[model samples]
Target: MLNLLSGLIGLVTLILMIPAVLPLLGALNWILVPIALFGAFIGLMSSKKSGQYFCLIVAGFGALRLFLGGGIV
Candidate 1:
């Protein structure tokens, strides 16, 4: 349960970080990107099962974004 929660939180954090981090990187503030990515990696690697669930969630969101209007970003 805790692993699942961590994965969910990490997935959400990555989604939220993208838009905010991208613009800042273009504006000359790219340092946070690696940090955020590292955090995501750590979160995902914490548990194998949870990581798989996280991937499924991300893929689902990606497909939804591609076919629909709403997106994680």
Candidate 2:
């Protein structure tokens, strides 16, 4: 349950981090990206096979946005 919670949070963070429509979201996302990654990582490590896969998707997308969303630093 906690794993799912974290994974979902990561997914939300990923959504918020997307800069395609909202520039302000992009600002907060830069700070939240690492936190989201950590949440996803924790979820991944603690989850079952299925949950792990979900977390992987969250982490992967978060990372993708982190680089492409202008949050690399």
Report the lDDT tens digits of candidate 1 across residue range 1-73.
5456556554664575355433223222133334334444555666555654564455444344433432222
Q: Where does the lowest 10-residue lDDT sum fall in candidate 2?
A: 20-29
Candidate 1 vs. true structure, TM-score:
0.34
| Superposed Cα RMSD, model 1 | 7.7
Question: What are the candidates' C-alpha RMSDs?
Answer: 7.7, 3.6
Clashes by residue pair, model 1: none
Best by TM-score, which number? 2
Q: What is the lDDT of residue 3 in candidate 1?
A: 58
On residues 1-73, what C-alpha lDDT tens digit does candidate 2 reach at each position? 7677776766676576566225435455456656666676666666454544565565566556556666643
For model 2 the local lDDT of residue 14 reads 59
Worst 10 residues of 1 by lDDT: 23-32
Error of 2 at 31 (Å): 1.7
Highest lDDT scorer:
2
Candidate 1 runs further than 4 Å off? 24-73
Per-residue lDDT of 54 in model 1: 60
